[model samples]
Target: MVFDRLIHPFCICSFSLTVSRTKSESGVPEVPVPADDTPEVLNKALSGLSSRWKNWWVRGILTPAMISFFFIIIYLGPMVLMMIVLCIQIKCFHEIITIGYSVYHSYHLPWFRTLSWYFLLCVNYFFYGETVTDYFFTLVQREEPLRILSKYHRFISFALYLTGFCMFVLSLVKKHYRLQFYMFGWTHVTLLIVVTQSHLIIHNLFEGMIWFIVPISCVICNDIMAYMFGFFFGRTPLIKLSPKKTWEGFIGGFFATIVFGILLSYVMSGYRFFVCPVEFNNDSNSFTVDCKPSELFQLQDYGLPPVLQSITGWTIVKLYPFQIHSIALSAFASIMGPFGGFFASGFKRAFKIKDFANTIPGHGGIMDRFDCQYLMATFVNVYIASFIRGPNPSKVIQQLLALRPDQQLHIFNSLKAHLTEKGLLPLLEEAA
Candidate 1:
């Protein structure tokens, strides 16, 4: 009887321990399991499946809707496009600064919010001033009001920035100084990331809509192609930061983007609307897209490979020079662009957040969509500076016009002497 009692209690204890472990492991409340025929159990299962299906349907509809809206905005023109970018910049700044505030919530720092916004305004003024002064020189020269602003643009920008700096310094509290400085650094870094990239994006847009559109489209194409390939064939993970990305997706997207870039270059190159730089015409009193397009937009014959020529009975293929440049753009979009997304993923993971914001139904946020685009923008700007952009004679003349009469005369004399040394002054005089 003693041994039987001992065995029974031991068995009971072991069973109780197993039940407790199961409950803990599953992380479910200790509720009684329903019978196999219970209506409640069947209803719960059906509800779960229905919820999942609804989510899938919502995502399907939202993706295309967002894409259509984007295309509509792009079709509107540069001014509309710029306004959208500015809105995005503000929203992204809010999201990032909000995160910083949340992380440093315990400090309860004063004036942090105001200071952040003030800095944003300062940076925008500085960058936009440079843009207007550079691209819209003629307008600045024509308008007396803008002439004053244009002359002291940098000084005005610096003074405004200094005012923000003084405000920040004056607002620092004794105990919260560390927190305030941390937030200050946060604001500046966010500005560098968001504002600087956006400035580059505007620069690309000013170069030509093609520079802006094609690079951005290549990024979008790569992203979609990558996702489709990953969803269908992904097995091996491409990176630990993003668990869903795969090597198959990356490689497939690369090839697809190259083809897409080539085709897009062909179409955009034919149109003066896409290839022409945005410029304000003094004669027309409005912006004009009419211009003789660069040679890159013009067609050139490229010799085909022997095997391809043999198969197609053609030795040469005609294509825009810009198409060759597109390969580089597409390649960067394929290779380095995804790293921008990866960096964002890692950033979100660091903060234990899914996305920067929930602005879009399925796409997380504007920042999420634009992470790669920002990187692509920087690349395009750098590419244009290194390979495409040249000194603008018109801008030079405008700068000379803005000078004092004596200064203008001195420049004119210097130019005439230089032309005479090159034996071009006689030709210029004869033509005149």
Candidate 2:
């Protein structure tokens, strides 16, 4: 009977009151109890939740594989990569337009979106776009490849963007608002994708992949340091823009990046890693191997001077591979990268959302993935432009400057010479 009474909810309440009264009557203060087995019940519930969180990453192999696939599309260099990003940009643009309109209350017109490529292209020229011919000559000295690639990219990207816009418009006509919004979001997406891809192509064309590697390495180091520290030592909030961020984590992570920069500069550059590596030589002929200079670079033969020795190892063996080449240069990207991330975070928060699409499971959406990268690319591009002008631009200025001296006389003589040699100038004179 006691056991049955203890099991009943109402009976338990009654029994608790009787116990409290008995204790009070006996001159003892009543001890408070929350309910029957409250602590144990809460503990069990918490345990179950913890288990789920601990094992959350035990997904199938496709999860990691899908992640790798996406990574390749972004970093695998031009050719196919340009196309992949074009598609992504179109998708992102649609998302942006939709999110702007319904959620963030941003205004955008249908016609503007439909003609966004042409619109932006015109604006691009005004902002800084130039003759693709001149732009390439400025970078590579020879503009042939650059010129061909430029025309090719312009035609393809514009066509694809226009096609996407038409699709969006058609979806609206068919009453498919779901896809209509998607197509709209795609335009913004395409902007980021195309911009990043183009920057990479240009980077490879100018200083080769080496110039671009700095941004990639630095971003990787920064992100890794931030996440590792945040996961382990996060306490105080780092910024209002991002609630989950921590000051301790950010500081710790940044310090780690500094260390990585220094370490890479020394280790990867083939310079001193504590003590610089000594050179060894083996000449094919009679040699002064013992008299060889103590240096980092190896000689082709045992007798060759260390200074004249062939570089036998990685080229950047003397400086930190991760160090920023230009301090004032990287500052823009450094500042912009975090700002971009904060903006994206703010966007997601505004919509009362957690993650974006869960494409990476742990990482969030494609926008989340690209937030920092997009800003970084833009910043770097601007930095390069500020420092380096194209050959065509340089040559054009040179040509115009040279014309100021004896300009008409030089042209008249050149025309006379051409007519004397080719006879075209005389034929034109006879016709006139």
Candidate 3:
């Protein structure tokens, strides 16, 4: 009798949970399709083709168009790229939150949507504020209001977040407490995934447009090559999460992206505008992308190993050092980047959805397209920190400028003493 009582309630709970999942709507929710959308036009144009061929044509047509738009944004400058990143971040957050709402039927919950958006705003303010303080320290110090905010940025961000937390607590009802907390957690995870990665992307951009452009272009290249190879020669499945992915496509994409990255890096390394870090010109009160090229961007002769030198009949080859780094970036994009898409695929499977949204014709949602890009962004940021970046002179000078006069003099004296000990001070005096 005791065991029966325990199992009876457990069975009821399990049955109820299963029922809820069954009732959850799936497959792109009930978004009303507009008659004049690009997908519709393409569908009509290729009505005579089979569905497989139709998808191929649609994706091929839209893919290059999207690449052209991306390059155009790059030409417009870094500011435009940052803005586009923000817009895409917002859209991705919305798509994920919408999925949570539909799956949980949480739309009726008070302050759910409002709190989600509020948290997004709070997070953005914190990140962008930090970016301003880091990259535009002069501007921040010049403006009193900005200086105050920069000083108290973290405290202000915490207070804003605490306010939202209290609102969520107050909004919770007797029976809806669990559901509200679930949504709260959902919102934070989405923020971590979308907002944080996008912030790192902007950081990479400030490092140099090459850092930003090369990794992203590699991911785009791998994605395209993978699909083309799969469509023509896919036989063995790559992963259960995405049935369309195949071993053949994966290998083909890897080699293609590496070559593409190397060529692209070599070409861009020659241009100062592409290779220089983005910086604010205090005199002109504008952004500048002009600097003497670093050794990484300069062409250097690399001798081949004895075995390879004999086989190829070449002693040494000239290449930008950045091109070697591109091999690492491209390798990651081709190998590990697909895991991000696989994760998204699993998330969709859990919700029984075909796509996140119908926002992009032939592609799924903006999130669908960016799933791998976010992962790639994170890797490139880490790679730069670990292997590529050195202590930034501009940032060091900015920090020194922020110090008190006495502290600044102390640093100057300390630096002179250290250089004097190294026998470098007399050379500096001679140069002066």
Candidate 4:
């Protein structure tokens, strides 16, 4: 469907080129030059944009259909979202492979026929990560979600995932393509997991959507800031790969992401200081008899660690471990977000394209929009793991919850001790 829909526009543009070439060859005996093409190109783009601004005839016909789909997904919730995403993934992958084949001439995809394409999209309609099936079985068994999934067991997960991979491969065979077995095959799998996992992460892991919102807000705010600064103040080019990307825009975007990231994260995590603990707290205050460390982050009148801890009535003994996360998060945002953008620029240059796809009016493709957040999220997830564990032991999040209650409490105490040693307080303890 993607190829079919895209091909229409591409073919139209191709036809225009053909007519121009023929006219030049037959009538004028002149070849088209870059300079001569600008007027016609601008006219075409303007015409295209104007045509896309449809009248009420089209708008009225489409509005209800659009609302229906929106309501079905938004009102129906995550299950619907998963089904929609699964369908999109299959379509996007199919389009990607088809385009690759046409562009590269590596193989002729026999299964790229319209029917075969629709068949895979239909399969998604039947299978939505076994979510409905599992729910039905769980309802029958009267089990909670965690228990229900556990009942299926690790072997079940392996078998199901393996089967899905097989089907995925089978779908590609008709497209007359094989996935890049080592690199892209794994990357494809990772993307699927990441895209699908966000729903679960927002729902179950974090207990709310807010936990994941910081990264998105930070990336978007940085993008806005970059464009604003670049357009208005950019003077020095940041890189030859992206000459339009100015140092002014780059630095502006960097600081914006860091500041916004820390601020957004503080909103999500309830920390007053918009930085990780490693950075210095610039203010100082008095810790009175009524105040405690729990409210250390309930910052006011500019206070220091000692003053805030005493004010909050927290044992001045344990403020260090808690302070580092904010500092780390802020620093990482400044570094990681810009790196993500640079990576995107590199990818675009490799493809010899200015943007991934002209899907957005001012921006690029869906992937282009999300790429920075994808990088930042992965960075934060990894950083949270290593920072929480330190050198003595490496504890990933998967292991954190499995620890016995007593072990969990012990680890908490160790964290407190570590923070106290560092001369800062943990956010949770400060909040408490």
Best-performing candidate as measured by lDDT: 3
Backbone-clash count (model 3): 0
Backbone-clash count (model 4): 32
> TM-scores across all candidates?
0.85, 0.48, 0.92, 0.49
Error of 3 at 269 (Å): 0.6
lDDT of 2: 0.48
The weakest ten consecutive residues by lDDT in model 4 span: 273-282
For model 1, the superposed segments whose C-alpha errors exceed 4 Å read: 1-59, 310-312, 402-404, 417-432
Residue 44 lDDT, candidate 4, scale 0-100: 57
What is the Cα-based lDDT of residue 269 in candidate 1?
95
The 10 consecutive residues of candidate 1 with the worst lDDT sum are 25-34
Query: Taking the tens digit of each residue's C-alpha lDDT, what string does model 1 give over 1-432?
Result: 645644686554434333233222222213222133323543454565664454445556666877798789878888777788888889888888877766555456788988899999999999988888889998988899898998899999999999999999998887666557867999999999999999889888878889988999999999989987876787889999999899999999999999999999999999988899989998889877778998989999999999999899999999999999999999999999999999999888766667777676446668888989988999999899899888876678777887999999998999999999999999999999
Q: Cα RMSDs of all predictions?
A: 10.8, 19.2, 3.5, 14.5
Runs with alpha carbons beyond 4 Å of true place in candidate 4: 1-106, 110-141, 144-149, 164-208, 265-327, 387-432
lDDT of 3 at 375: 99
Cα lDDT for residue 12, candidate 2: 50
Tens-place lDDT per residue, model 4, 1-432, is: 546643686554444333233322112212211122223444454554543332222333433554466456634443344355455454444433333333333333333344334434333333333433322332323347644454455555566556655655665542224322322343344344334434333222121222234444566667667766887799999877667778898788777767676555455445322221211112332111121224323343433477677788764343233233544555565556667667767755554445545443334444555556556666655654454423312124325555889998999999889988887776656888
How many clashes in each structure?
A: 0, 28, 0, 32
